[model samples]
Target: MRRTREEAEQTKESIFQAGIELLATKGIHETSMSDIARAAGVSRGAIYWHFENKEALLREIRGRLQSFYKSLVDAAHIDSAPLAESISRAVRKLFKKYRNDAAFRRLQDLNIKISVLYAGKDSFADDIIKTEEADIQLFCEAVEGSPATNSCSPLQMFMIMESLVGGLLIRQYIRQELLSDEDIDAAVAFMVKGFSGIEEKTKTIHQEQ
Candidate 1:
């Protein structure tokens, strides 16, 4: 018998959830489609119905995470605020999500695992950075929208900002140091004040010119 659209959607969500849990506990290479099927309480055929292979399934998982991050970016939107403040709010918003949301944290853990553990692999490793493409765009827009746009290329600015976030996350994940409340404040300061100096320097040069 054919499944209802809602049933198909639920099965897909179940497969995603099960895949995330297994990827975290078992690692990507170790987990199989059958394992995901068993964990999701679906048959192997059901798994294949949604994904052609494990790589496709992994990409789908990353897609969901990308959307989640996009939502965070969207929620942090402060149109009336200055670009730096708006972007800072977005970053802080994400940090809060990381601290408070178990699923968000696990998704991050899974992200690090895919990017780091499978760096040499084919599709898995590719998906890691591919998922970040939208965020890079988000940061680009934020930086270009700022008064500091004259100081550097938006891509350069995006890389610098994302690096700060990525470095902190990797270090914290490795060292098992949960971010202190102070760290969140420091993040905002770093993002905001970091560019303040750049903007000032650019203004001086432009005035001199």
Candidate 2:
């Protein structure tokens, strides 16, 4: 008997979910189509019918995360707020989602695992790096256009922001304790202020040269 469209989509979603869990917990190299089929309670044939291979399935997962990150960047640019405030708001929103959304958290965990385990050896890793560089460039352009003082270069500002958020996320992942919105705001403020003297320091050094 042939399955209806709805049934096929449902089966695909189940397989996708099971694949995420297994690949995340078991590591991508160790997980197989047969394992995903067993976890999804579907036959290997069904898994193959939906995804051509494990890499195809991983591409779909990566697409979802890319969309999620893109939305955050788009929303941050939707208004004329100061760069620091906009970044702070986006960071707080991200932490809130990580704390409240199980699927989002799982996807993040899976992405980190993939990057760690396959960074130099896989096409997926190259794609991940390209996506991240594109995202950072978007923010760098925003910094250049903003009215804020360029105490540091746009690229430097972006690297600082990325480091701050990435470090906090790793800390939260290990501690399993999300920081409060107020705390995040304070941290962002400090980061913004931390570079306020860079322009003056550079001027002093240039004068001495």
Candidate 3:
């Protein structure tokens, strides 16, 4: 029997999700198309029909994550808003997604594992490194473009923000606890205040020099 287009797409999505879960838990080198097929309850032939290879599937997953970050970048670049407000809103939204969105949580888990497992290795390592560097540049540029006073370098601000946000997510991922809204907000506020203080200190140094 010929499968309907909707059915084929549904199967493809199932296979894709299964691949993510296995990759997140087993690491990329340990996962196989057969594993994904078994987890998805589909045949190897079905997996091949939807994806050419594991690398192709990983690229699709990376692309979805990139698109989500791009939207956050856009949100953080609002011209009329204060830089701190814009950044806080974007960060809060991301933390909220981590707490509430199961699929997003899985994607992020897969991404973190991939970077840790592949760094300083081969092609996949280089690709993930370049992608991360580019993402950092995007956030830096957004910060630089903001109207609010920014005495610190954009890269400096971005590094601090990334460290805090990444640490929070990593802890959440490892501990299996969806952090409370109040906890998330308090952490975010602390980061913003720290960033603001750094900017002010930098400005004072510039004035003295």
Question: How many clashes (backbone N, Cα, C below 3 Å) per candidate?
Answer: 0, 0, 0
- The best candidate in terms of TM-score: 1
Q: Is candidate 1 or candidate 2 better by lDDT?
A: 1
* TM-score quality measure for candidate 3: 0.78
Q: Show model 2 residue runs off by greater than 4 Å.
A: 1-7, 180-183, 192-209
Residue-level lDDT tens digits of model 1 in 1-209: 99899999999989989998998889899999999999999999999999878888767656766754465356335568665676677677767777777898888777777666657887666666777777767756655555578878878766676787778777777887768779989988888888778878888998999
- Give the range of the ten consecutive residues with the poorest summed lDDT in model 3: 143-152
**Which residue pairs overlap in candidate 3's backbone?**
none
User: Residues 84-137, candidate 2, lDDT per residue (tens digit)?
Assistant: 556666666777787778889888777666656666776777777676777767
Model 1 TM-score on a 0 to 1 scale: 0.85
Residue 150 of model 3 has an lDDT of 52
Give the alpha-carbon lDDT of every model: 0.76, 0.74, 0.78
For model 1, the stretches where C-alpha displacement exceeds 4 angstroms are: 67-79, 122-145
